[model samples]
Structure formats: C-alpha cells, structure tokens
Target: MSALRTTGLRAATGVAASALALAAFAVAPASAADTTQASVQGQSQQTAAKTQQAKKQRVFKVRTEKQLRMAVRKANKTSGKDRIVLLRSIKFATGKNSKGGAGRGDLDVRGSLVVMGRGKSINAKGVDRVFDVRTGSRLVIKRLRLRNGAPAETESGGLIRSRGDVQVRKSSLLESTVTGAGASGGAVMNDGGMLRIVESRVRRNSSERAGGGIEASGGTTVIARSRLTGNTTGAVPGNGGALHLTGTGSVKVKGSLVANNTAGAEGGGLWNSATGDFTVERTTIRDNTAAGAEADQGGGGLYNDGGVLTVRASNIETNSATGAAGSGGGVLNNLGTLALSTTEVQGNSAPRAGGGIEANGGTTTVVASTIEGNSTGAAPGNGGGLHLTGAGKVTVDTTKVLANTAVEGGGLWNAAAGTMTITGSTISGNTASGAAADQGGGGVYSDGTTSITSTTIDANKATGAAGSGGGALNNLGSLAISGSAITNNAANRAGGGIEANVGSTKVMLTTLQGNNAGTAPGNGGGLHLTGAGKVEVGQSKVHDNTAVEGGGLWNSATGTMTVTDTHLRGNVATGAAADQGGGAIYDDGGALTVSGSTIENNKATGAAGSGGGVLSLGGTLELNGTNLNGNSAPRAGGAIEVNAGTADLADVNAVDNATGAAPGNGGALHITGAGTVTWANGRIAGNSATNEGGGLWNSATGTLTATGITFEANTAPEGPDAYNDGGVMTVNGAVILPGSGI
Candidate 1:
C-alpha cells in the first residue's frame, strides 16, 4: 500500500499505536475545558472488556451445605473470580460433631465468589455459618437472610467470618450468639480484612466478651444505611454491644441506626481504640445502657480511647450509665479528640459526672450543637451536661446548653487545668441543688481559665445551702467575659451572678441584671469577691440586683478592685439592719478604685439603713471622675455613709441624694465612727432631708477636710446644708451657693 493510504487507514482504525499515544495526551489535559473526552472513550473500552468477562461468569444453584461446598470447590478449580452461587431454603440442622463453621462444614470461599439469594434464606439452626471467606479471598453477598448460628467454647463469629475482604448488601444477620471464654463478634468478625456493608441489618446478637454485632481489626470498614438493634455484650466488663474496632483500623458510618444495645462496661453502641479513627454522619444512637458494677466504667452510646472521632448531623438520645459511679452517658472521650457539628445530645443520664459528655486529656470541639435534658443522678456528681479536665481544650461555638441538673455545675464543669472557650452560645434554665452545703454554680464551674464572648446565661438557680453561692459561675481560676449577658439568676446565699475565689476576673462590655441573692438576707446580688481574687469591670452594667447587703457588689478582698466606664443602677438592699445596706457597694478592706462610672437610682430600704450608694468600712475608697446621683436612703447617709475608712473624692458628682420621708442625716455626705472624708473639686447639689443635715453631716470622732467643694440647693428641716456637731471640719477654697448654705 502507499504511505498516505497506510496513515489514513491507521487513523480510521482507532486501535493504532500512534492513535493510542495521542489518546494519552488528550487524557486530563491541563488548560482544557473538555476534560472527559479521552476518559469517556477509555471507559467505553473498559466496559466492553467487562462485558466479555461477563460471558465467562457461571451460576450454580445449591440447597444444602454439602452441595454448596462442592459448588464452591468446583468454582475455585475453574473460573474462581467470575462465579455466582445462588441459594435456596437451606435448613441446616444441628450436628453432633462440634466443628464451628470451618473446613467443609460451611460454605467457605477459597477465592473470589458472589452470593445472590433471590427471595431465599438460610436457617443455620445452631450449626454453622452460611458464608465464610478464607484467607486471600474476596466475597460479595446480597439479598440474603442468615439466622440462628450459635458457636460455643471460646470460638467467635457466630454467623460470618472474613479473613480477606467482603462487600455485603441488603442482607440480615439475626439471632446469633457466641458464648465462651473471650468469645466475641456474634454477628460478623473481620480479621485483617476490609469490610463494606450497605442496607443491612444485624439484630438480636449476643457476645460473651465484646462486639455483639461486629468487630474489626487492622482493616477499614464502611457501613451505610444499616441498622443494629437489641444486641448485648456480656453481663460484666464487656464493651461495644453494637460495634468494636481495634488496632490501626478505621471505620466510617453514615445513615445508620444503633439502638437498644446494652453493655456491662463501656460503649454500649460503639467503641474505637488503638489509634483508630471513626467518622459518623447522619446517624442515630439511642436507648442504650452501660450498667457496670463500680466506678471508671462509662459511655452508654460511644467511646474512643487514644483515637479520633468525628460526628456530623447525628443524634444521641435516651442513653444511660446506670452503675454506681459511672459517667459520660452519651459519650466518653479519653485521650482522644472529638469533633462534632450540628449534633444533639439529649435525655441522657449518668450516675456520676458528665451526663451528656465527658472529655479527658484531649481536645473537643462543638459547633452549633445542642446539649439538653441531661442530669447527674445524685450527689457527689457534678457537670450534668458536660465535663472536661486534664489539659484539654474545649471550644463551643453557637451552641445551646439548657435544662440540665446536677449537684454542681448544672450546665458544664471544666475542672483541673483545662481550658474552655464559649462564643455566641446560650446557657440557660439549669439548676444546681445538693442535699446540703458545698454546691454552687448552676450554669458553669471553672477551675481553670475560661473565656466567654457574646454569650447569654439566664434563668439559672443554685439552691440548698451553698456556702457562698454563685448562681451563674463559681470561678476558682482566671475568667474573662466580654459582650455577654447574665440575667435572672438566683442563689440561696450570695453572689447571684458570679463568685470569684482565689482568681482574677475581667469583664468588659457585659451586662449583669435582674439577679437575686438569698431570701431575706444576702450579699452581692450581682457579684462577690473573696480570698485572693481580684476584679476589674470596664464598660459593664450591674443593674436591678436585689440583696440584703451590697446589692450590686461586695468585695471582701485585700487585693485591688478597679472599675472604669461602668454603671451600677436600680439595685436594692433590704431587710433588717445589723451591718446590712449598701445599695451599690459594700467595701471591706480593699484598695478600691472607681473611675469614669455612674452610680444612680439605688436604694437602702432597711431599718437604720446607711450608704445609699456606698458603705465604706476599713478600706481605701477613691472615686475619680464618677457620678453618684439620685440615690435614696431610709435612715442615714443618702449617698455615702463612712463608718471607718479613708476616701478621696476628686472630680465626682454627688447630686440629688435624699433621705425621703425619714428621720436621717447627711443627704449627700455623712461620716460616723473613726474615718476621714476628703472631697476635692466636686458638686453636691439638690439634696433633701426630712430631719437633719441635708448636704453634709459630721458626727463626733469624724474628721472632714474639704477643698474646692460646692454645696447648692440642699434643703432640710433642721440643717439646710451643713451640720457640724462636735466634729472637726476644715474647709478651704469651698464654693457655697447664695441660697444653699446652712
């Protein structure tokens, strides 16, 4: 032939060597939009080859175990990779010889085989397994039912055992049992092989040790659209009633259900260990129980040890850890990482701590999740919703923590040096109640550093005689809160919002409102500070707080308290008077500084009440660039009652302070006991009194030194502006209005 004719003929026939070389260049080229042009043609050729392979496929029909074994052996001798075994009703009976699904007693595949059952089932009748894959073999089984395969005397895998690889679809494994020494995997066991299950059921299985449904080791397993129900593992110290994985294997479960499973130790549904990784999506794990006898056993739904677990769009509900000291009813994460997105954990319970989740030593992250309706069973149990400890970091973003109950920390407890961050979350409607004392923090308890931002904590309660109550938080470590709201919390004793013990607190751009402390006599309705704890408030609000003493704040610390750009208003101090009443603040032995703040519209309404704004007792109180106005008292010192303290007031406003309709003294400034009050460059105006000393009153043993002070429009029935009775008062550079002096 001519050369031109030869080239044209080679191009016409697509199997030419030069044409195939050009096909490689056209496959997945960069800078090309028609990406699948060569791949589509190549796939067509591969499909033609597969069609030819299908011509070699053969089918065998069997009705008994002996016939199935002969067929499998014949298929292995001939076309082992392309043979199908069709099953009918095989009523395999119980035999006297004790051989469990091995050698010639079962349908053992020595090579690749396909099992297809068209409306047929296999009744093992407590004899042997229906299908078993040997070493170096592959199996595919579909549309089948396997039942009543019970193995005895330390042998595992009552129904199916795979030493190679398997792919199962639309099948059922039911009523299987493995009871002996260390017997496990009542339904299926994969030993160093890959497994894939689709649209299958594993039910009513029991194991003497672990994994009542499935167990996998040293391989990869994937299960989708499957169901596992009514399975149990042992009666004591057995784990993973549904599934278990060990060694360096991994599992992924999607669109599955694991329900009504029970375990005696931990992981009633699933367990993963030995550096395995697990991922679950769109699944449900519900109504499981872990009923151990003693402590250190938990995880009614799932557990991970020394591994990583990730879940998305899942639900864990109605699980329980019913032992004496069990914990983590929903999930137990020990030395592992847990990441959840859009998950819900509800109606779970534990006997000890962490009714919803417990994390130890590894990081846990929750994004847009809900944790609700969980509870710790009784006393000596804390953290009803969640617990974290031991050098782990927990991050919760846009989550809801609600309606949980415990002895302490009804919502969450971060204990022993863990770090936690909550952002854009809501924690509400939680209750903390113990039998007696030593219970507090209805919302959260932190023994480490806690950071909160843009969060809401409301409608929480801490009752039953807490020693020093913290209805929202009891912080023993550093706490930082910004752009948050703390409202409608109640405490039985004190500190309805926050209590800081031996830690520092920093709050900025936050609100503390509508909180109550104690029924009749309490302290620090908004906040309390004791021990070596310090507080700093900037750009914050403390309002509508009710207490018996220190309605807004109480500081009994020897440390420093700094307030800047803050507001304290609409607070009340009520009930009897023995040392009770400071409508805004009661300072006791602290270096207190207030600057750029407003203290207004507060009241001290008790009998013999004092200091409508502040009661200074043995502290260094300094006010700079502050406003104290419109405060009312029933008895004495409508604005400030100095019992025993030293105060320096500079650039401050003491205005509209009144002792309305009461026989009291010092509508603006009053000093009793051994204390010195020094006022510099301030305005004290529009004060009214029903009895004596409308503006300034100085008693015996009280010293007043005034400079650049102004007193205007103050009225009284007895003293108009100033009443000095046997007290040392020295005034310099003072400005008195024309009709405002006494």
Candidate 2:
C-alpha cells in the first residue's frame, strides 16, 4: 500500500512541475509599438547545450565586462549566426564598439544576438547608444536594465539603435537623453526595421524633437503589456513624447500605458504618420501635454496624420494642448481614417478646439465610447469634446458624450462635409459659454447633415445673453432625430433644447421635456428657429419647458414647420415682452401646420403677455384636429393670440382656458394688430376671462371668421361669449353669443 501511494504522489508532483513551467513564461503576443514591455523567459531548463527546435542554440555566458566585449566582437565577426549572450549576475558600464569603430556606445551587433541578463544592468553613462543592430542583424534583449545614455543625435537612439529586427522583453530602459534639432527617440530608435517590446518599461527619456521613448519607421512595430512614462520631447517644437511611428510601417500597441508624457509642439503621447495602419488596444494614455502655445499645434495624447488608425478599449484622459490655436487634446486625426471602440476620452483640454478629439479631413467612427469632462483651455472655441472638419464623416454608436464645455458645441462641433450620426448614444451635461451670440450648442453643434437615433440629449446649457443657445442641439444644417429624448436642458439666452438656423430639423418619436430657454427674459425655451429653416415634429412630446417667450417652440423662419400627432404641454412663458410671449408655441414667420396634436397646460405669466397656448405674429398658421386646453394668460388670449398673421383652426378644441388677471381678455382666443383667425368645426367652451370677451376678442384692425363652431359656457362680465371691439366678425355657421342665445 505504501509503495502504491508513493507512485501516485510522484505522478501528481510531475503534473505540478509542468504547470509551473508553463505559467512562468506564458507571454502574451506583442502588439505594435507603445505597448511593448520587456519580458524574460523562464530560466532555460539547461545551460549551454539546450536544444530548441532540434537546433543547437549556441549560448555564451559573460560574468565580466571584458568577456562581454569579446563575445560581442566574435558575434559581429561571424555575421550570420544565431547567438545568445547571457549575463551571469554581472554589472557593466560599457562604452564604444568592440573595434572602437563606427556606431554609438557599448556594443554593435552585425549578427542576430539574444542578450539575456540574469538580474543585471548595463549603463552607457555619457555615451550615445548602448547597442546598435546592423542592417542584416537582429537584437533580442531579455531581463535587463539598460539606462543612462545621452545621445548626440536623435538617430542614435540614446539607449538602443536598430537597423534590423529588435525585441525587448522583461526589461527597462531609463534616463536616456537626446538634444538636437529634429532629433528624437531617446530610449530606442528602429530605423526601417521591425521592433517588438513586451512586458517592459521605458521611462524618463528626453528628446529634442519627437519620440522621447521610442521611434519606429518603415518596419512593423509591436508593443504589448508595457509602459512609457515621464517622457518629454522638444523644449521648442517636439512631437510624440512617448512614441513616433512614421513611414510605411504598421504600429500596434496593446495592453499598455503611456502617461505623464510632455511635448513642446504636438502629440505628447504618440504620433503616427505611418501610411500603413496603426492600432492601439486596451491602453491608457493619461496626463500628457503639448506646450506649443502658438497657433495650429495640438494633439496632447495622439496624433495620427496618415494611415488607418484604430483604437480599442483605451482610455485617454487628463491631457492638455496649450497652443494658442491648438486643437484636439486627446487625439488629433488629420487626414486619416480613425476608428474607435470601447474607448474613453475624458478630462482633456485644448486652448482652441476639440478638447477630446479632432478629426480633420477624414472619416471617424466611435462605438461604445465615452467622451466627457473635456473643456477648452481658452475661450472662444468650438467642440469641447469632438471636432470634425473638412468633409469627414463621423458616426457614434452607443457612446456617451457628457460634461464637455466650449464656446460652441460643448459636446461636439461638427462642420464636416459628410453627414454625422449618433445612434443609441447619450449627450448630456455639456455647456457652451461664450460672449457672443449664436456660438453655442451645449450638446452638439452640427453644420452638416446629422442624424440622431435612439439618443438622449439632456441637462446641457448654452449660457450668454443675446446668444443663440441650443442647450441640447444647434443645427445649422439638416438634422434628423428619431427615438430620442431632449430634456432638462437650460440656456441663458434661447433654445433650451434645440436651435435650428438656416437648417432643416425632423423629429420623430422623440421626447423633448423639462427644458428651459432663459432664466431671465429670453426667447424660445424649448426650441428656437430662425433664418429660413424648416422643422417637423411627428409622434413626439414637447412638454414642461420654460422660457421667457415661446416656452415650447419659437419659429421665426422663412421656411415651414409642421407638427403632427405630437403633444406640447405644461410649458410656461414668463417675460417682459407683450406680443412675444407664448406658453406653448410662438410663430413670427414661416408657415406652420399642426394636426392631430395637443397643446395644453401652458401659462403666460407676465403682465402684457399673450397667448397662453400659442401666439402667431406672422406667416400662415393652420391647425387641424388639434386641442388647445388648460392654458392661462395674464394679459390676453388664454388659449391663443394672433398678431399680424393668418390662422386657420379646423376640427380643433379650445377649452378650459382662463385669463389670470383684470384687464385681460380673450380667455379662449384673441386676435390683435393685423392678425386674422378663421375657425372651422371647433369648440370654444369652459373658458373664462378676467375683464371681457370670455370666448373670442378681436381688436380693431383684426378679423375673426368662424364656421361650424360651438362657443358656450364662457364666463366674463362684459361679454359672456364673444366680443368684437371695432373688428370684423363674420359667422357663417351656428355661433353662440351672450345675448343672442344661439
């Protein structure tokens, strides 16, 4: 029995040993650039004669500085050989090439070599590069600390320079420096060669121009599970404090971090102009800065000027671009296709525009992302979160844009030539504060065709007196919204929810509620329209909005507006304007048509105010199968007031409306100035006036014509039903008057 137990225990021990061996060196695949870290393979099971793929893996162990020099010389002499140099717990302060010839610092390899350190370090105290790989050679570094290099030129790659393939794993490169015009890559430089870094760290590198940490050109670059920290470039005109990838090489970075990087010009974290695709996945780039402080310099986190750039599951936060006219603190994509998924861009600031992202002349798509807490460092800029310009198409899906502040388009400012769309997203808590008017769209400012589907725009603001405020959306182009909600938005001037200027807006199956246009006296609480624009709302709700005038909707356009099967209710209009106050809707120009809709529970709460439910100043207004009820006006027209305009009400109900104070008239309907009202097949009942004209009141020069109308149960002292004060009243069908009794 004892012998059998011993055999079982031995079998279990063998399985355990195998598991440990696999777990120790199970390295993930390397990504492209910026993410590579140094990783060490588990100590080789055998020392000198270990077999790999049935080949003799020549290995050399160096325990002293002299031995290291000899080994490098031999490897270079035997050019095309595969060799591994192991540092057997040794430390070296190396300098110059083996032949004391060309190249920088320590050692030069003309053949492929793997330099593995057994918990050792190498420093090139005042030299250029610690190691340089020749064109036909390759260098692999594992478990090493390589630091203290000061290169004379950027191409020297302060610590390591490679003209061939280079792989670094489980290593650290620190305190490298480069000081020269257009010089960069303090830690490492890959010159038209492939570079891979895994499980390593590159920190405290300084450069004069770009790529304080790493620079890759032409060849493929992959970085995985690494960190590039505290890298700085260019006290003058730097770019890419952490990484720079140019030429035709592909760059891929995964599971990495680039933080606390600083650039004097652009791209504080990374700059890629590869023309051969760039990708970053599961990475974080935070606390970076670009300090040009001049016009047209930006990209605090990343700058992609060429190639297709894709970022997945990344976080870019707390970055700043301080150029006088700089843009894109988080990412600046210039003439490149940018695709992002599951990314968060937050707390980034630019002096001018695009605090989170700026896409210039390219197509961009963001899916399941978040862009929030971004702001312009200076005033008078657009697109605090995102800026799309020069014919770029931007599509956002399942994204959230929140708490971004700018002078215009706090969440997003889109002037792209192609259409922009937001599907199943949330845009909220954004603000646009400017000294000028019409420079605000707290949530989004779109100057092109924009489609919003299944999105929510709420709690945004555009603050400025005389400012054109679209608390939720400002559309100067074509806008289409479906299955969306715009609510709890505020503006200090106008347009609490939306503002359309010289644009067309279509709202379908959307809800617009609890919006405020102005805290004081302003116009258009829920929406503001002007400048030859068209608006249409169908199967939607516009309710509980507060404004100084036109509480629910204000249209002063030369185009047309139509609302069908929508509800406009619970709105309040309180201000100083006598003829401009409208609790539910105010129309100054453009044709307006309302059918199968309801306007109710609206109030005009100021002295000399008019139109508790609706007010029309000019243009043709038509109402069909609509209901206007439970409205209160302090001045006149508890339900509707018209001035110098045309109105047609057919099959509509005006009931439960009242005048709030004395000297008020027209509890249900009032027409003044050059206005004309024609009613057909409608009921005006259960209305009360404080002074006179319980049902209908027409001032001199006004006209009221009614047909198939029923007016009853209206209470007033002077006129119980209808009063015409020197105005034209032509009744073609059964009209009930106070004294006429029928």
Candidate 3:
C-alpha cells in the first residue's frame, strides 16, 4: 500500500509542476493584455480632459457680421481670456445703437479678448467706428485690415476708441475719418489707456480737429515698427496731423515712420502736449506740412509744447511750414525741453524762421547731428538751419549745419533774448541772398549772446547788393568767437568774414583767411565794424583777404576797433580811387588801435590807390609796437597814410615799402588834406619811391612831426629821405643813414 501511495504522490507532484509552468506562461499573456487596456483607458481620459479644456477656452470662428456680433457677445460673457478668429472678410452696416453695449454698436469689448483676423479685412462702410473698448477690458487685434470707418458726427476715433489696454499687431487702418467741429483721432483714440502698436500701418486718415491718425490723452502710447502716412487735419486750426497727445502719460515711437501728413495749424506729423516725455528713436518723419498762417502755428515735423522731447538716431526730412508767420519746418520746441542726438534734419523749408529747427523759450540741445539742405522763403525769412528766439538756452555740439539758404542767417539765427553755445561744429556752404541793408549772415546771425568754440565757418556766400558778413554777423549783442576758422567766404558788400554792428564782438585765437568782399564797391574783407560797436581782436590771424577799400579790416565812423597780437598778411585792396584804399586797415572816422601786431605783404594795386598798410580818414589811428613790412601801393603811402586824420606811431617799424606807379609819393609815410603824422622812435628802412619822397612826403595841407627817427636805404627821383611840398615839417634827432639823399 505504501509503494502505491508514493507513486500517486510522485504523479501528483509532476502534474503540479506542469500546471505551475502552464500558469506562469498564461500569467505573462494576461498581464500584457491588462497593461494594454490600462494604457488605452489613460489615453481616453487624457482626450476627454483636453476636450473639456478646449470648451472652457471659448474660441469662436466668425464669417458674417451677425456671427461676429454673436461671437463678441459670447466672448464678453465668458470668464477667462477668449479669442475670435475671423474666417472671412466682414462688412458692418450703418447700424443703430440704443446704448453703448457689447453686442451692438462698434463691437464693444468688455473683457479680455483677442481678435485674430488671419489676413482678412473689416469694413465699417463709413458709418461708425470699428471697435470700442470699455474701461477695464483688454483688447488685442492682430493681422487685420480695418478700412473706411467713419465715426459719429460728434465722436472721434473712426476705427477704434479705447479706454483700456489695447494692442494691435501686423494690422492696417486705412481711409478712416472723423467729421465734427472738435472731433479728432480719425483712426484711433486712446483715452486713459495703454495703446501698443507693433508693425502696423495707419494711412489716409482724416480728422476735423487734431490727430488725423491717432490721439492719446492721459495714457501711454507706444508705436514700434509702425507707419503713419497720408493723414490730414481739418481746414480750420488744429495740431498734429498724424498723432496728437495731450495728457500726463508718455509716448514712445521706435523704428517707425511718420510721413506725408498735413495739418491746418501746428505739428504736421506729431504734437506733444502731454507734460510727460515723448521719445522717438530710430524713426523717420518726412514730407509733412503745416499750413497755418499764424505766428504760433508751425512745426511741420514735430512740436513740443511744455513737454520733454528726445530724439535719437532719427531722420526728419523734406518737411514744410508754409504759413505767413510760421516757423520750424522740422522741429519746434515751444516752452519745453528738446534733445536731439545723432539725428539728421534735411531738406526742410519754412516761411518765417527756423527751417530745420526752432527753439522758442525753452532749452534745446543738439549733439552729433546734421542739419543740412534747409531753406527759408523770401523777404523776412531768417534762420534756415536753426532759429533760437524768445529767451532760451541752446547748445549745439559736434554738429554739422550745411548747405542752408535764407534771407538772413543761412545757418543759424539767435535772437536778442536767446543764449546759444556752439562747440566743435561746422557751418559750411550756406548762402544769404537778401538785398536789404539790415540782412546778411551766410553762416550765422546773432542778435543775442553767442559763444562759438572750435568751430569752422567755411565756403559761405552772401550774394546780395547790401549783404554783409559772409561768415557771421553780430548786431546788438555780445559775440565771442574763440579757436575758430572763418575761411573761403565771400560777400557782396562789407565783411567777408565777420561783421560787428552795434554790438560787442571779441575774437581770440581765431583765423580769418581767403575772404573776398565787395564785388562792386565794398570794404572790409576780413573784419567790418560799424554802428557804434566795439570790436576787439587778440591773438588772431587775418590773411589772403581781398576788398575794394580795406582788405583786412574796416572801421566806420562810430566803431571802435582794438587789435592786439594779431597778424594781418597777404591782403589786397583793388580800389582805383585815390581815397578808397587801405590794404591792411581803413579807419574812417573811428578809433583804431593796433598794438603788438604784424601787418605784412599787403598791396594796393590800382591807378590812384593809397595806403597800402594803414589809412586814416578823419579818425584816430594809433600803432604801438607794430610792424609793417613788404607793403606796396600805386600812389601815396606805401606803409602809412593820413588823409584828413591823425596818426600816432610809437616803436613802429616800416620796412621794404614801395610806391609802384608813376609820380608816386611817400614810400613809408604820406600826409595830405589837413592830416597830421607823428612818429616817435620809429625806423623807416629800404623804402623806394618812383618820383617824390621815399621815406616821408608832406603835402600842402599836411603837418609832419618826427622825433628820434632813423631813415636808411631810401631811393627816389627827388627827396630820398624827406620831401615837403609847402607843408609844415618838424624833425628832431633825425638819424639819416647811408643810401639816402635828403
């Protein structure tokens, strides 16, 4: 029995082992199936969650106007952020509005919503605005074209009226208008909202008042990579044809364009009355116009009134202010602060003043900028490049003012109440063509207090009958020029380089070279002083100047001139008349003084020229420690001449003086017409005359007094040392050296 039981147990054990193996193989297949079922169930749950989230997101696709209205109403009812996607272009009719609600008039937005247009268009049919955002709502518009929207007769913003935060991206606003007596913002009006425009265009918009394209009040407006063009204001008086801001918020334009806009009053492109900052960077303002005829209406490009305006790396070009009394064709700072850096203002025109920029009663600063190719209109036009008037402080540093034209002040004009400082600048290729007697300044005109340092005024012309100061003119003010060069300037009348009239002018360490004055009959090639002014030149050089009367300097009856440590060289006087020649100086009824100065290589070449070095006609001429060398004249006075005046010489040297004409007299000194010449401790050497006195000549109405005088190497046909033709002569301690016959 034990043996049978053992056999059964062995069989059972074997069977149990086979069963366990079968169970293991089956368990693998069952677990694989269960894992597959669990994965499938998880995927189903995920799909259902995603579907529920999408339903809560609230996305609407609209094709017709009714669908769009329903989508907007549903978006307003939704809690979270909603999106309305436009499937096709939609046109809105002239619908009636019971009140300003969400589902009706203008598609009012009352919640955070995004309207995506997918390159489609929305037409308003010239009836009402396209969008009106409520106070607390947030609206975002993208890839849409909004056109032909006309707001109500009493409202602004034909396209959008936002009182909340709004953003527009890659969109266009075109042919929108607002028509009322005081309506504004033909395209968009942001009232106490944050308006952000990116890569959008606003074009061909019109408004009855201001802001033909955009108006922002008490909000922040930012435009980036956008364009505003072909906008127009009403025919009445308004400001800002493209953009107007009058609020306490800031406005910023970056990498944008504002062009081809027109205004009836001021600021054809942009007007900032915000009291906050208005900043422009890397933008362009071009081909804008202001058509007002009033004195306070101007600024074809930009106007800043009681605001802060900062422009950097921008261009303001081809703008016009076509009013009878308008100014600032490019930019106007009226009672505000303006700063321009690394910008260009070119090809601008104005009727009254400030063709490129105007600063009136404000602080203005320009650094590393170029103001070029600007012009002003006829007769009373002034300040082609920059005009500073009405009590302001202006600073121009490292700037170029070039190729400007005007009646007066071709480059810059500073009025009597303005204070200007120019440093490291260039004023070149400017022209002033006014025929009036009180107009001229090819480079600059200053009736205010002006200071110029390390500047160059070159290649300027004053091509008028009575124009003066080819380089600069200062009248009724104080002008100080230091370390500057005034070269290659031409004037039709007086002062080819500078004119100081009824003012106080000081020039120190400056150069006046290659200047020409008086194509017909004028004087003062380098410097002219008139109208009871005081002019002081110290440590300066005047060379290569040509004029009819005074090649180097001319001082009028009431002018006072003082020259100290200055050099006058290579000056020519081409007058043919007997009393109209002074190669170095012509002092006619003035107080002229030259101390420690050098006058050399001056020539008076004509038939009846006189005074190659110095001429005094009814004035007081004083020369102390001065040298006159290589001076020649055609007739009378190669070095010094006194015709109806008094000349006093102390420690003066007259060397190598010659009279080249036939019957010439006075190689070193000439006195005639009731004049007096006094010499004390002076030397006259190597003087030659063609006919009469080689060292001294006294006429019948002249008087000559000499004390301690040395005469050496004088040659003439008669009286090599001294000649008196029935005149009074008193010589004391006269040392006549060899090669002279007295």
Ranked by TM-score, the better of candidates 1 and 3 is 3
What clash count goes with each model? 0, 25, 0
lDDT of each: 0.76, 0.79, 0.85
Judged by lDDT against the true structure, how good is candidate 3?
Answer: 0.85
Q: For residues 473-513, write the lDDT of model 1, one tens digit per residue.
A: 64668888899998888777777777666588888999988
lDDT of 1 at 151: 57
Clashing pairs in 3: none
Superposed model 3: Cα runs more than 4 Å off: 1-56, 94-100, 732-741
Q: Could you give the candidate ranking by TM-score, starting with the highest?
A: 3, 1, 2
**Best candidate per lDDT, number?**
3
Question: Distance from true position, residue 92, model 1, in Å?
Answer: 2.1
Instruction: Report the CA-based lDDT of candidate 1 relative to the real structure.
Output: 0.76
lDDT of 2 by residue, 121-234 (tens): 777675556787889788889988888877555354888888888999999999988777867787988888889999999999988877889878668889899999999887
TM-score of 3: 0.90
